[model samples]
Target: MSIEEKVTSIIVDQLGVEKDKVKPEASFVDDLGADSMDVVELVMAFEDNFSVQIPDQEENNIRTVQDAIDFIKENQKA
Candidate 1:
């Protein structure tokens, strides 16, 4: 699967949300109903799946699904 597909899959699995709900513009907190802990777990999940370490500061900026997808595409190990 592509990076965008993988990121959307991760968010769907982690958040227990519908696949259609994993839109690029959807915000983890505001749109998807994720709490702070959920965000942390999601970050860990992303790191594990993509083999990339997202720093603490960068984590805060990843509010939307597109943000996570972009970060992974940019930083994931080949």
Candidate 2:
């Protein structure tokens, strides 16, 4: 799967949300009903799945699904 697809899948699995609802612009908290703890878990999942370290400052900026996708795409090791 592509990075976008993988990131969306992780968001769906992490938030228990329908795939259709995980739009690129959707906010994890405002749109997907994720709590702070859920966001942390999602970040951890992303790090593990993509094999990248997401610093706390960067993690804080990942409010949308696209944000996660972009971060992984930019930071994933070859």
Candidate 3:
């Protein structure tokens, strides 16, 4: 699967939300009903799945589904 598909899958599984709601523009907190702890877990899940380290500073900026997908695409290990 592509990076977008992988990221969307992770988001749906991590957040316990429907796949249809995992849109690129969806916000983890506002749109997806994720709390702060959920965001942290989601980041950890992303790191584990994609084998990339997301810095704390960068993690804070990852508010939307597109942000996580972009970060993973840009930083995933070769």
Candidate 4:
């Protein structure tokens, strides 16, 4: 799968949400009903699955599925 597809799948699995609900613009907290802990776990899942280190400071900007995908696309080791 592509990075965007992988990121969306991860969010769906991590948050237990429907695939249709994991749109790129959807917010993890506001749109997907994820709390702080869920967000943290999601970040960890992305890091582990993509083999990328997402710094704490960057977490704030990764509220949307697209943001996480972009960040991983930019930083993940190929």
Quality of model 1 by C-alpha lDDT: 0.94
Residue-wise lDDT of candidate 2 within 1-78, one digit each (tens)?
999888988988989999999999999999999999999999999999999999989999999998988899899999
Candidate 3 regions with alpha-carbon error over 4 angstroms:
none
- Candidate 1's residue-wise lDDT over 23-71, tens digit each? 8999999999999999999999999999999999999999999999999
Candidate 3: what lDDT? Answer: 0.96
Taking the tens digit of each residue's C-alpha lDDT, what string does model 3 give over 32-62? 9999999999999999999999999999999
**Candidate 3, position 44, lDDT:** 99
State the lDDT at 17 in candidate 3. 99
lDDT scores of the candidates, listed in order: 0.94, 0.94, 0.96, 0.93
Candidate 1 — which pairs collide? none
Off by over 4 Å in 1: none
TM-score of each: 0.96, 0.97, 0.97, 0.96
For residue 57, model 1's alpha carbon misses the true position, in angstroms, by 0.4
Error of 1 at 13 (Å): 0.9
RMSD of each: 0.7, 0.5, 0.5, 0.6
Best by lDDT: 3
